[model samples]
Target: MLQVISLVLENKPGALMRVTGVLSQRGYNIESLTVARTLDPEVSRMTIVVDVDATLRQQVVKQMNKLINVLQASDLTESPAVVRELVLVRVRTAQESRTAVLKEAEIFGGRVVDSSTEGFAIEVTGAPEKLNEFIDVMGSYGEIDVTRSGALAIALDARKLKLQPPVPTKAGVKMEETAI
Candidate 1:
């Protein structure tokens, strides 16, 4: 029942606050949120994950689109998209467990970002499920301190969300083919 809702909003003061406020006021719990400036400095993209059923999912998107600074909002949960999260883990490593931890990290495509006699700091990025599995495996090694960057997602279909407008020519004419 988790939905991935993506929004393109004007990068203006209170833009983020307004969007979040709407959700909070409605009493919807946001599972995760990731926001960053898009290629256009004037715009920002936000990826929000909320655990809502189908009926509430539609309501969330509808409310988002009604926000003043919001350009577009789409639920990407059922769409073709690439989603990922980054996790940094510091795991207690003893001489006996160091090799096992390193090997597990290697298998999960995690990099040893930092290492000391007591522990190893590993950086891993992948689908949320994959990261969950890696974290579970790492937990067996010893105590772990974890930091996660919540889900960030983008639709694969061009029509799902468009943050950029058509390009303008020197003559001040918008190019049709350049629309994205």
Candidate 2:
């Protein structure tokens, strides 16, 4: 099973290494990891995806939480959350296929970040599966180079379930937020 684990850690040297060390020491292979500073400069958030059985999932979370700089650790695989990834692709295409390449990128909602006589550099962001499809389409164009940002995810707000003042909607119809 693939488990998504989110962690909040103090922004200190080696904090990330320590957290990854715990997992590596246990022989867990991380599928993807994305880490960045949060609003507060002193803290950083990390989203890690790993393949592990149910028992191993529990052990990974427990070990992560025990780390000194780790403020929190939660397994988000079982929670309602939104997850996304970003990819950049540079494709070298023949003049005859340039138009088709750009058209395909537009259809995929990709932005042409850079362009030259040699090729086009496109940026796309969405669910990992969507990016995979986009990459496959881009590959058909010609020789290409690709780079990806690992998955980033956040759990939905549980407080949204509580009774509260009605949220205003643009067209007077209530809008519901659903996790992706």
- TM-score top scorer: 1
Candidate 1 lDDT at 126 equals 98
Task: Write the residue-wise lDDT of candidate 2 on 6-99 in tens digits.
Answer: 9888899999999889788878898899999999999899999888778878888998988878888888898899989999999999999989
Give the 10-residue window scoring lowest on summed lDDT in candidate 2.
157-166
Q: Residue 63: error of model 1 in Å?
A: 1.0
Instruction: Itemize residue pairs with steric clashes in candidate 1.
Output: none
Candidate 2, which segments miss by more than 4 Å at Cα?
Answer: 158-180
Best by lDDT: 1
Residue 177's C-alpha lDDT in candidate 2?
Answer: 38
Where does the lowest 10-residue lDDT sum fall in candidate 1?
171-180
lDDT of each: 0.90, 0.88
The lDDT, on a scale of 0 to 1, for candidate 2 is 0.88
Model 2 — TM-score against the truth?
0.84
